[model samples]
Target: MNKLIAIMNRVLSLFCISLSSILVACVIWQVFSRYVLNSPSTSTDEIARFLFIWVGLMGAAYTLGQKRHLAIDLLAMKLENQPGKQAALKLIINLISAVFTTVIMVYGGGALMLKTLATGQISPALGIEMGIIYAAIPLSGCFMSIYLLKDLLDNLTDISSSGTSTL
Candidate 1:
């Protein structure tokens, strides 16, 4: 499990880095074309927007897996030495996050992508299928779900052993 999670973390990190690099390049080209060349590239703006979405979503998933995502731990801090309660709280939090990510980002985003594809929607500037750009939503949601599952299982194990939450 640890190995799988480590592999996932590496893949997500690479994915986000690649997308971010492309996004930066696109923005640079757009800026250079607009100011230096006196003409902006038509597709760079749309491409940058799409890449931004992918990079942001994947980066978030990577951060979540790294346990580096922002979290308010006031209640958790209060729990302190109560390993069982803290573990329970962590489990509940992971469960809630899993449900929300599945329902909103996965299901809803999938539906939106399918509907757009069905309508043959395309981006104006890039002439690319809009559904392709929207694919990031459900993909990131799935990644988040995986991380949440791992956290959930870890919390469960901690509860069984009366250990502090590691998530």
Candidate 2:
């Protein structure tokens, strides 16, 4: 499981790096085309936007996997001495995050993607189906859920093995 997670993390990181690099190149080309060539590249602009979306979503998933996402942990830190309280708080937080990501990102995003697919709408400049671009939402959501589940399992194992919690 850890190995799988590690592989996923690496793949996601690579994806983000590639997407960001492409986005930067696209932006530079756009600027050059507009300023130097006196003609903007419409396809590059749309491609950059799509790449940006993928980068942002994938970066978020990568951050979540690393447990680097922002959180207000003051209360958890304060309860460190109380193992039971700390465990409970951590569990509650994980559960809440799981539910939110599952419902909003997973289900909602999937639905939105399907709706767009059914509409058969194509991007103005790229002429690609919009649903393909929107896939980043559910993909990121799945990645987040995977990380959250792993964290939850690890927390439970720790709590059970140590007979206490130390979040």
Candidate 3:
């Protein structure tokens, strides 16, 4: 399990890094083409915009795995028990997030992903298939949901082993 998680972490990390690099490179090229060449590449703006979404979603998943996402702690800190309930409350919050995202994955993203099998949607610039790009939404959601589940399980295990009330 640990090895699988580690491998997932590495793959997600690489995926995000590559997407980010592409976005950055596209933006840089866009700027160069407009200012230096006196004639911009028409696809530069469209490609960059599309790649930005991919990078943002992929990077969010990476942050989820790295446990680097910003979390509002106002409620968790105000709770009664510090160590015990804090973890439990956090798990509940994560569970809620997972459930919400799962719904979006099913309803909103599912149409975009599963039903667009014959999609011919193309990008304005590169004429790239938009369906392929939009596929990242559900894909990221699945990965993010997995991270939440993993976090919840870890907290549950900790509580169970320690006989804590929070779990």
Candidate 4:
């Protein structure tokens, strides 16, 4: 199980890194074209925005693996013991986050894809299918679900290991 988690983390890391590089490359190209070449890409800004979205979504699972999400710690104060309460709070938060992601993935993703497909719209520069780009949402949601489940399991097991202690 630990090995599986490690592999998942590594895969997520590589995925984020690769997507980030694409974003960075696009930014560099946008800058050079706008300033140096004096020929701006009309679609550069939109593409950059999309890439930013990709990085944000794709990096989520990796951040979860590292426990690097921005979170308020005050909730755990309700319980007496720090570790157990923290674990419980984290599990709740992760579950809620996963559900939120699922909602966005299902509705927002489907709407975006449907709109683009129906309107015959495509990214100006790449002319890529909108569904291809919009796929990031559900894919990331799935990735996040996996990470959240892992976190919940790990936290619950931690509590179990601590031996039915009060908190």
RMSD of each: 2.5, 1.9, 2.1, 2.9
Better of 2 and 4 by lDDT: 2
Ranked by lDDT from best down, the candidates are 2, 1, 3, 4
Model 3 misplaced stretches (Cα beyond 4 Å): 116-119
Q: Which order, best to worst by TM-score? A: 1, 2, 3, 4
**Reference-based TM-score of each model:** 0.94, 0.93, 0.88, 0.79
Q: State the lDDT of candidate 2 residue by residue for 1-167, as single tens digits.
A: 89989999999988899999999999999999999999999999999999999999999999989989888899988987787668767777888989988999999999999999999999998899999999999989999999999988977876786676544
Model 3, position 163, has a per-residue lDDT of 67
Each candidate: what lDDT? 0.90, 0.90, 0.78, 0.76
Give lDDT: candidate 1, residue 108.
95
- For model 1, the superposed segments whose C-alpha errors exceed 4 Å read 163-167
Task: Give the Å error, residue 44, model 1.
Answer: 0.8
Q: Which stretches of candidate 2 lie over 4 Å from their true place?
A: 164-167
- Tell me the RMSD of model 3 versus the true structure: 2.1
Score candidate 4 by lDDT. Answer: 0.76
lDDT of 4 by residue, 75-95 (tens): 666664567666666667777
